[model samples]
Target: MRHLHIRTPRRRVIGALAAGLLCTTGLAAPALAAPTAEPAAPTLADGLALTPPMGFNNWNSTHCRAEFNESMVEGIADLFVDKGLKDAGYQYVNLDDCWALPARDADGKLVPDPVRFPHGIKAVADYVHAKGLKLGIYTSAGTKTCNSAGFPGALGHEYSDAQQFADWGVDYLKYDNCNNQGVDAKLRYTTMRDALKATGRPIVYSICEWGENKPWEWASDVGHLWRTTGDISDSWGSMLSILKQNLPLSAHAGPGHWNDPDMLEVGNGGMTDTEYRTHFSMWSVMAAPLLIGSDLRKASDATFDVLGNKEVIAVDQDPLGKQGTVLSSEGGRWVVAKEMKDGSRAVALFNETGSPQHIATTARAAGLPEAGAYTLRDLWQHRSYNTAGTIAATVPAHGTVLVRVSAGGRWATRPPAVELGLDGSPLVQAGRTAALTSKVTDLGRTPATHLSVTLAGPAGWTVKAISPTTAGLLPTGRSLRTKWQVTAPGSTATGSYDLTLRARYRSLTGTRVESVLPLKATVVVAPPAGVSSLGDLPWLSTTNGWGPVERNTSNGESAAGDGRPITLGGVEFAKGLGVHAESAVEYYTGAACETVTADVGVDDEKGARGTVAFEIWADGTKVASTGVLTNAMPAQPVTADVSGAQVVRLVVTDGGDGIDSDHADWADAKLMC
Candidate 1:
């Protein structure tokens, strides 16, 4: 499923440390190079937070201005206690951005805005702690916060700022990605994680990168929770969009790490009561952070009913912390199930349509334990039903029917030791190939065998083993490896593509099971580099060229209008600048690119009679040009020093001659970057 960018954009991949494979000759092949160590699962404050955090933030409600002062936060802290929210488990009072002054003080320490916090952040921290609630603050990975208010961010001052936060009794930090310096999410986030750990004050590090770099795949150990989508708006569409983006990422969430689909907008009035119910239910199932983004001082009773649902909050705060799984979805109805720490199961029948719908699923099919009779308790309706088979419920449109299915009273037996783990780079460049590898570790008493591995990728893609080997015949205490090579065409654009890995095998107890792991990888394909053809580069505009906006390599036309590969886009130009006919393609230079070159000509098939010259441009300035040629002349060359040039344009212009049959072509054009 394609995910919406939501918050910001950005990732390539780095993986866990693993020994590189050595060939029969004891030499490591270049293709199987080892990757850099990726962000390890954090151990700081290890075992501290075991479930999705429940809290209140100021951004979504107050927009982070002067009105969002200490009084508001204090009121929220008070409301959590008064409305049974604190007793039911919502504890954090988070201030999201705009609480600090524009710049650091003379000591380089961040200063709280005097007008807003009057008594300083330390005083506010004491007020929240007095009520048994934790205090959380916000910062950005960049030099400044998201707003022009200019609160000093946690960039160059990570360690010092972390120490200051610790001194102020800060329990959590919501680190955002605003004005970010294009740093990799892993690098920037892990830096703060380390800084927080160094402070010796257990702060729950929240990574708010806006899901640009597919944080779910790389941010598991970098922070307590990572935002998997963009900032949430109060609108129904925005909330639903974020919810959908976080659906498939449940496998990565557990005890310490959580996937945050931005803060909640439930009591904020952007959505109706039904839509609000669906939002809360979905977030609970996904184990997403339940941060209230509404003003507590004036919250309506209806808001209190939704926000104070103890049963629903209990499911969200379930100690097991496993993200809910979508068991089935048909005709806009979905049945999602989350395993509770107590061994019971939390199931939700959601109606995504606008009208009411009949949603149902069998207990076993919903992944509930023990395929037998179970009692279901409706969380929202506060009703109970004893059923032995299918659990059915009619759900209102844009609403949910949440229930707790009894685990039949006890937990099931644990499985044996054999398991499957996948390790591979999630990137594949166009016109190039990469490898995908899987490993099986056996630690059980039985000797397992007859294992099968299957792989699948996007359409127009190819996958096969680099070298064939025996098909899974391993024993106890043994490890085996499987590999495949993946390739795509140069014309392939950059996008997210999943390379699904599945393994099936029999365990020592004669039980057969299939393990499916989602390995996230993106296909990044760029234009030709290092003395490549110009035709291969994508055109910026065709009106600026001679023919249709694209290149014409085939269609019985020649590269350079003769018979070559220069016409990659199959674009045939008829004239040049004289007849108002022109064509150009932009290429990049500097660092990787040193030179830009091209072959220009008129096709032999069309009397190719036009005054044409080849030209090279650098950042809008004409850098070089070739002699004029008319009639069906030989293809001329256009070469210029493209070193340090950011944008290189290749142009074919009509000479002094008026275009008659001036079919022109620029073949074999390429950049050295």
Candidate 2:
């Protein structure tokens, strides 16, 4: 779902009227009137999606696999009711692709896939409606869909398909852009808009054009929502990139139309819980769609907690429908504020760096009126405090603190804010110990009494306090620091484990309050002391634009083991890694590797159609890079200095053009210790 195209901003032209003299012996001539006003841009006028649509889509969790059947769809509908999502404003249960047969029926009508939908699409839609929910379907604006399977689409059959959807009780349509036959984007989308309007059924239209045509400039009148960036993957880099792309277009979003950055990946397990919270908070602040894109059946309690946060959801569903604006952003620290319907401001302090940072912003800066005092409510912590118009927090890396600020509220005591940290890397060997720290600060107006902090790890792991873990009293603007040594058992598996930090204290009114923060620890094995092929080692994490990164092969199709011998510019090698553009593979070196060497270039499998660049990073610093390599060039040797580096990352990015066919190869990549 990636696209690249240049777009010129549309402009309005005005004509000047000239007056004639007495050439014909005439007196004063009548003045020329201004041209008639242009007609208003066409809007849906359906009064739908006044707030960003809240729902679920199956593509992210189950794509066109066998698990995406009627049973699964019905099960999700049931979970939406049982898991309190329905009550929380999630309404639609949608299907993305591969829902219909490959060909049209005798009357040129789309036929439901019997194997996927036993009783047909209508039966499933009826089931969803019975649960007081709605159903949505997907189709492309071309002759075929995006998947390699190539299902039938609705390009030349807009009216017929619209009627069929209305008759089948469909309430929403997600029209995509693939194989579009080079048609004008506005014309294609407007045609469907007219077709849907003629059906007399209120169907939400989602334009999925991947922002190639600058839809934000004209799509507000055509679709209820439009995709504002490329597809999203479950990685920190992917989420951050998309966020940057969508944030600058805030002026184009409002009530009835939204800028979509794709669906949620909170429970996908590719990132930590802290990162997921940041993802949810940013999306809500931007007033983006709140579509759940994970499998609810296997979702964890932590995932549900993030998705079911009512206060955050309120910011997204606010009746004012104003998207948050960036107050300040510098040095990976950001402050964003959204105007709410209740005359309050929703402020978010976000930290995108690799360490904690203190971000600050005043009420006036956030678009709020002057008052004696402002009430700041921490949406995630569910606490309120009275402040003299100052909103600030020491946000953790990849974490966000969301607060609602309003004027003229009763002064009340609030709980102290606590931050957790690790002295060194979170990675540890089995039977090894690590140092953990905590800082509890009383930001309220009064003192906190009987303050105590404790660190707890998983069962069978030991935690011992290295410093005083309790305090009798903590005054305002004062902090209490505590440290602990956590040891993992020898039998512990090589994976991530959760550690919890708990703090308890009495407020000004002598009411006991408690706060808990979750932390992640990873156990990894160090590489052997010798030169070895990188393909033989385990990667800490990987994110590729297409399928999984291949081992010991060339970039082939988008499937594991589908590659052939490692080939670059007609030269073949026996061992290497194959990846697509916009890819990253990270490995834990534990500061043991001395150097890394590789032959990098665009894979020959794509002929002369790809352009990409290769980069090597050590401990967040770029060590070496191949500026730009194309399929027309030969393989180039690259060497990177990795001395005293704990981690090494290999990256492939699209080279100026786009990621159309940027299949890249890392031939004979080796790490020497």
Q: Against the true structure, whose TM-score is highest?
A: 2
lDDT of 2 by residue, 627-648 (tens): 8788899999999999998878
For residues 285-400, could you state the per-residue lDDT of candidate 1 as single tens digits? 88888988888887899888898898898888888887887776654578889998777788988875433455677778767666545666768867444445456654554678
The alpha-carbon lDDT assigned to residue 351 of candidate 2 equals 78
User: What lDDT does each candidate get?
Assistant: 0.64, 0.77
Give the per-residue Cα lDDT of candidate 1 at 394. 46
Counting clashing residue pairs in each candidate, in order, gives 29, 0
| Residue 499 miss distance in model 1 (angstroms) | 48
